[model samples]
Target chain A: MSTPIYNRVALIGLGLIAGSMAWAMKRGGVAGEIVGYARSEETRDTVRKLGFCDRVEDSAAAACEGADLVVLAVPVGAMGGVAQEIAPVLADGCTVTDVGSVKRDVIDHVAPHLPDNVHFVPAHPLAGTEHSGPNAGFAELFDNKWTIIVPVPGADRDAVARLTSFWQALGANTDEMDPEHHDLVLAVTSHTPHLIAYTMVGVADDLGRVTDSEVIKYSAAGFRDFTRIAASDPTMWRDVFLTNKDATLEILGRFTEELFALQRAIRTGDGDHLFDYFTRTRAIRRGIIEAGQDTDAPDFGRAQKK
Target chain B: MSTPIYNRVALIGLGLIAGSMAWAMKRGGVAGEIVGYARSEETRDTVRKLGFCDRVEDSAAAACEGADLVVLAVPVGAMGGVAQEIAPVLADGCTVTDVGSVKRDVIDHVAPHLPDNVHFVPAHPLAGTEHSGPNAGFAELFDNKWTIIVPVPGADRDAVARLTSFWQALGANTDEMDPEHHDLVLAVTSHTPHLIAYTMVGVADDLGRVTDSEVIKYSAAGFRDFTRIAASDPTMWRDVFLTNKDATLEILGRFTEELFALQRAIRTGDGDHLFDYFTRTRAIRRGIIEAGQDTDAPDFGRAQKK
Candidate 1:
């Protein structure tokens, strides 16, 4: 492993992304020591038992003490509170970053609370699974995944480079993007799609004509993927929708317009319109496979589950 | 391998489902001889080269000659024409079934044309992948999948029993349902979800702010699964929506109402409403996993893709 990037790294939340980050750092030996904190004592105990970090601290402030790097891995709604709590304890020259999906709101909430000496670079790892909590993490979660870093204006260049290398060491390819664009990109990529999935699953449940047992039994027919996505943590998604409101609403507007047009085509027996739309969407899937973001394997490699 | 379920089995369309059926039949020795036909000579040539069938026939009638079981694996739109073409050649005591997603349409279109001597039992195998064509087939595609059989009123019981055994021999569990309910269940479980996925992918493409490259590169954030579902066969999905128009539109309407409510909840900062909706959807996913229709593996077992 490469030399340690930071003397001490503090992770302020013990959830999926944070736990995975700890595991990835330990596997790559990227930090001299890792300290962790969570709002809940139960989560801290679980993390200690799992040995995800070098030390478990009672509070976020305690975890940040003497650490050269502090990562805010809490939900989007809790970022500001955690930032305010840990701001006083951060060491000089420490780099502060976050793994929140909405960057503009996170930067707005986190930037003012951090001291001038501490470098604030907000980052979002473009990777996750349906599972959450401390035990749901593995070292390979970030391998070959893209972690986008949104650096604020006039931020320290050396600190940004150091954080970039830190993420690189954890098996992710890093890119720099501005906060507003990052939020909009994530709105299109993650936020709206998740909401749509959740909405479809809700509709299926609300329909009394189709029994819940029937939906579950025959879920392989396209609905199963939506269910997988809809199964993501409710609290986290609630925060995402609330924090990224404007961007998510804009994307949802476009999505609703497109959906209405397709619905009209189906009603009018316009096969060509439906066929062309589906055909065009196939190219995007091909592009994703070519970019190595996903696999070309059929069924999303479902056979591997067995 | 078990005993042959039929002396001769004919597959009318040499696409993914039909080709996979041929492979499964060969692996299980469910059919003594498999005859395959497609509207296109290219597909027939590919099927012959892949050896998915024991014999490649020039026409649907030729394929059905002397066959005790004929499977119409064509798109829902093309089922009637193929049924009419092969009606004269279907042998006495032969069983004719289909693997269409929309059962009511398939039954309405094909049942009238079949000869009285033959038994017509409409079946739908609630399984598929985004990929299609003859080359996309595999012997294990049907393993542990559910195949629902919809038998018309006064349909021959013996024919239904034999077809159930055929699907079971191919490693699938079987159930019987009425055609109307089957169409409604599939609309909830498959049709509306697919249309939503297609529309979401289309919206992502239409957005100028998020470039296609960015969308493709960052797709794993829930958009990847939407792309996969949107990449399904254009013709097949088009036919499905057109054939199951009433049920799909009904579900789409319900979906829109639910989506609008959630959108309002987000606008009003109603976290409890959003949280409750998400929480309710999670239970359906859990039920899917418990019912053995989907794996609880995070990311749909995507790590195995690498």
Candidate 2:
């Protein structure tokens, strides 16, 4: 009913999040034309075949032409290069944003390459899956999820408000945060947890104490929980660790301190200590479930399997 | 078919695993009569309400009377006490077995108290739920799972074979192991991982950094995976850590060593290290899924939501 927010919207990398955004944009009728580009020729061809974009461009600069909004959806490590490549062609009045998990580095990397006319709004949709690539995107992925925006202070208020409304139309709850706090909170909530999962699964795989057969066959108990997270896109996680180094390292340090105390309790045959720790952790889980982020199912799939 | 394997089977505790065993026994017609007992009056009443047994007795000695297979399914911390309580009343030629997680301690606790005419076979059924108590039990919980038995040397071969058949009828694949090795293997595969999960959740809760609301809202990402695991029964986990102290501490030490190395990588902005670790873990998840223990979906959910 209302005018489309952007005349042309460009996606620099048509991976899972980018492709999903394309679908969401089309379903919402939010953009006049959606343009996409990917690093690989095969990926570009695949996005074209999937029809996730109105036009598939081979270069970031090509995609940026005539775009009033450009979203850099590549791994964070690639954001700087993409911004540099697209800055020259970016249309006047266009807004540049990113879907990177880490915020401070993304802002640092992209803001310098952008023209004064382009408003750089760094955002994280706080939604994903273990699956990657163009074909994995879905329209509802961002529905009811949080999208945090980190806009430079005193920057274009109208652009910020427009992006907020756009994410709302995509079914996301939007909030503004300073880039540092965003990175710190996400470190505790996402990055540290992901790294722990990857480490534990790696330890098991390297030990060879339990054959892969045993780990898999008996995984339903608790190990399977880690595997899902460990299966996330490796490249994205690598960039995240590289960029959010301080906060992630600080959380990991805190986590290890707690773990060491637990190990000491176990070593000393301290039943009450173990009991107290286990009991405390249960309350947190109950709170999480009560808050509706999780199901009350005893194990992840037990109810369904039973 | 042939006379039921046991004329009367006694279950010392009727939690998830024990209740499932009773239902599985009845479903497969493996026992002529199943007698169950619980420590507390409330649990006994709940067991009676659930109709998981042919008869409920208030005391272990009374329940084991004339029982041909007396099963101790109490917490690992209570195995010795329960075994001692029932040894005098257990029928001659009865096969006394346990369904505890740790085998060496179970053997040490239960084997010495048993009469010569009665056989003590320490068994660990690698199946369960985060839920405990009689109401949480279901018939098929053990279906297609594993049950590992650690029989003492010179134990009755016939008794061992009969116990093997019983678990097989309950829909588990049974394997024999040296109790010490079994404890050590499980220490790495199950106990240590559970402790780590609990510790991580506890750390997050204590920091209060993620905020309870944010945790549950964004929990569908990776934190919810830890929540399911951390939700496991406190008493059972407490007993596991106390009883399997040496193996558990050993594995915990190894895990911490690896974890610290990872922390250092994060602190140093080592993207390559993080990427390599994450990539290797993903391969392990693939192996587990191929082995039929896990599904590709996160938390093994039926549908991949978002």
List the DockQ of the predictions in order: 0.87, 0.59
Kindly report which residue stretches of model 1 are placed more than 4 angstroms away from their true locations once superposed.
none
Best by DockQ: 1
TM-score, predicted candidate 2 vs. hidden true structure: 0.94
Query: For residues B188-244, what per-residue lDDT tens digits would candidate 1 score against the true structure?
Result: 999999999999999999999999999998898899999999999999999999999
User: CAPRI verdict on model 2?
Assistant: medium
lDDT of 2 by residue, B1-306 (tens): 545888899999988888999998988889999999998999999888889799999899999999989999989889999988887887888888999988888788888888888888889888877788898877777777778988899978888999999999988888888888788778766887798888778877877556766665666556767877888889999998888888888777778778888878777777788778888888767876786565565335422442
Model 2 TM-score on chain A: 0.95
Worst 10 residues of 2 chain A by lDDT: A297-306
Write one digit per residue (lDDT tens) for candidate 2, span A94-192: 899999999999988889988898888888998787889998887877776788988987779999998888888777888898988888778877888
For every model shown, the clashing-pair count is 0, 0
